[model samples]
Target: MLLKTFRWAFAVTALGLVAGVLYDGWTALGLVAILAVLEVSLSFDNAVINAGILKKLNAFWQRIFLTVGILIAVFGMRLLFPIVIVAVSARLSPSRAVHLALTDKDRYQELVTDAHPSIAAFGGMFLLMIFLDFVFEDRDVKWLSWLERPLARLGRVDMLSVCLALIILLVSSMTFAAHAHQHGGGHADKAQTVLVSGIAGLITYLVVSGLSDFFESRLADEESTKSDGAGRPAVALAGRAAFFTFLYLEVLDASFSFDGVIGAFAITNDIVLMALGLGIGAMYVRSLTVYLVRQGTLDDYVYLEHGAHYAIGALALILLVSIRYQINDIVTGLIGVTLISASFYSSVRRNRAARE
Candidate 1:
């Protein structure tokens, strides 16, 4: 089982290498590997988030998430989305755009490079909405009721997420529509486009994050079970609702990965490199999710999940801010790292206190 499983990972890596060599040559392939590591490292929180959801899913859905989810991540988000953006922004026919991207690497790079602001803006906003909804909408009074109240009341992360999405929708579509009207008239109005795109990014964050939280909470309600047997190892079930819970988890993973995958193009656009580097990082995320689930980290740490979720909420806000601000991904990664680290320390301290 282990060998067979390991083979899948090996095959994906090997295939990515072959694709890179055939398409872009040795140097590009090297960059692909490097970028993938960077993406995975930066997105460890994604795995933790995913695992929290995966534990709620049924066995079949888990397989589907691994298989179909990987396909979407690699082909759809990583490969196609950038190409689509290039095609539209560069005013080339779709086929021509792709050819340009592949053969005329310099021109292609120039075309998409400037689109980063828009991408960052969109992702930032979307993530902010998600973070807000989860933290603010669902408030329980643990020992930290005093703190939780302030956090929950201040727009409730979930509500903020929804509002962000609506704001982005109004802003992006309006700009695009206006631009379409003015298409061949001037300096391409890239700045205005970037601004609109940034707003749209915030909107996307709101919608995706809000929906994810809504669905997750609904599933949690459906899965609510008091039986001890329900909370078993590998996957603890609050009830048969675990199936829906799992589904919600997968969707959540998809949402968190959106920015990571989209932002990756800034580093390099070779599909092969994107796949290999991001794929490896995703593998570790998968591993992390499974580790978290198997270790019962949530049950033990209690507030660790809370802290991570809160951190995710913060990240979403940061991403929203980046729509206009252009905050570096490294800074974003550091924010997440700090939150997770703090949560980890808290967990350890709690454990020690219990033992004492």
Candidate 2:
């Protein structure tokens, strides 16, 4: 199973090595390898969460996710999305962003870095909500019973997650804005940017979740009608369900890519190289997602998803802190890997105890 799952990753690594050598000699190959490792390490939790969603999809949609979804992940998110960020943030044309990336790499990096506060706020808030919602839900299976039980009880309060998120945002923006102003910068402007960006993130989550629920409900009704009436009428309904599912997956992947894209700048400021390197890593992550679903890894290790959510919560907090301080990327990546690995170990111990 391991050999079969990593076949594509091996092929992509070979292709990436060749491309790196041709583009900028052997040095580029090393950078590509490093970036690939960084991406995979940071995104393992993302793969676990993706499996939870992908399992609900039909086989056809699953295949589409591996094939079509990969294209979007590689070219759309890894490549085009960064360019769009530079374009909009710097108030330049897309062509200008591309030219600046290839020619003025240092300046391009500065602009991207300048935009980080808003990007961090947006992605951080979105991910925090995902973690909070998962932890608060009442469930049959409990991973960290002491902590999760208390959270589940608190979940009964209406809009608890939203309220908590807003309070955090308020405190963070005000404190950071004040700090920035003490050095003679524009305090009010900084605070406004954070507030707007955070709210945009919150609204995005609400809209996407609402739309997905509506589409899923419609699909369920169609399935019931088809089962009762006996006909091929439900085929169109299946397509609609697939469409909404596709949208949800794309949005989720985009949120995951945000941190990776920004963090890549810390490694290499060259946009093309970042894309090539990170693209290879993304293909492997997608392959891992499919492998997990096929192997039923999530079913075998029930605490795995819980661990991923905890890692996400940790990451979200780090990003939020990064708005005012520089957090080491290595430290951020290690926290995620450690949490997930510990959970996997606990799961193994539990399975053994059950057998005994």
Candidate 3:
């Protein structure tokens, strides 16, 4: 069963190595493996959160998520997204931008990094959806409401998260904008475009998220009305809690992927390497989720979900902090791992205590 579960990962890894060797030789292939391991290690907590959601999803969506969803992560977000950022900021066409990525590899990062605002916008908007979805919902079996209220009294809604995002925008604009300006006027116009793109992205995030929430609530109401039965969904996937849990996991994955995605740039800018490195990490995350589901880790541990959610909160803050500090990726990865590993260990102790 374990081998079956990892079959695809092994295949992907094998294929990736083959591709790397053909393209950039053995050294590059080794780099890919190292990057993949680092990505997987950094994203372990994301796996636990994802597993929690995968347990609730129907088989069809699960397959779609594993297949189509991964493609989105690899090609759409990882590859195309960066190119899009480069194009929009540099005023190049998308096709030209991609050509630049392949040919003038030297200029690839210069173009992309110039579009940091857009990159931040994509990641920022996605993370915001996650924050609001998990933080705002009313849930019967909540694990994090204890921490949610003080944040709530600040606003009935999860205003704090929004506040945090706004503060980030303000700070980023203040800091990066000046630096961008100092870089001079020719780049100045493009920098403004990037800055505006980030703001636009934030606004887009608010609109998209508000709509998703509205539709989800409506669909949920309709589903609840139909289920006029006695017991809840046998899987405990029925209530607001479950919905938020699902939302939380998706957003958590997005958050965890943020650094991996950004840091991938620091590696070879080959789309294949980004895909393989992050894809391997993604595969482990998917497996970890299944492992947790099969083991009933969340149910058994009780506080595990809380710890993970708290970690998400901290991760978000860390992301915001890193916007300025440019804190090295290794340190950021370590902090995330330490918090999550501590949570997992705590869960294990609790589980043992109950068994005793």
Q: Pick by lDDT: which candidate is best?
A: 2
Give the range where candidate 2 is weakest over 10 consecutive residues by summed lDDT. Answer: 176-185
Output the lDDT of residue 336, model 3. Answer: 65
- Candidate 3 lDDT over 234-289, as tens digits, reads 33344444444444445445546767767777777776677766776677667666
Q: What is the TM-score of each candidate against the true structure?
A: 0.73, 0.92, 0.79
Angstrom error at residue 163, model 3 = 3.9
Model 1 CA deviation exceeding 4 Å by range: 1-7, 18-26, 138-147, 153-269, 324-326
Model 2's number of clashes is 0
Ranking under lDDT, best-scoring first?
Answer: 2, 3, 1
Assess candidate 3 and give its lDDT: 0.63
Candidate lDDT scores, in order, read 0.61, 0.83, 0.63
Instruction: Give each model's clash number.
Output: 23, 0, 1
| Predicted candidate 1 versus true structure: per-residue lDDT over 1-356, tens digit per residue | 44444455567667776777787788867876777667665677776677667766666666666676667666666667667877887677889887986778667766665554455445555555555555665455232457667756775443464565566545543444234332243324644665576566555444554565566565555445532556423333433344445445544555566566656767875555676677766655665566676677777776666667666776655554443344567777888788778777877887899899
Best by TM-score: 2
State the lDDT of candidate 2 residue by residue for 47-147, as single tens digits. 99888888877788888888889889989988888788889977899999999989999988888877777787888888888888899898888999999
RMSD of each: 5.6, 3.2, 4.3
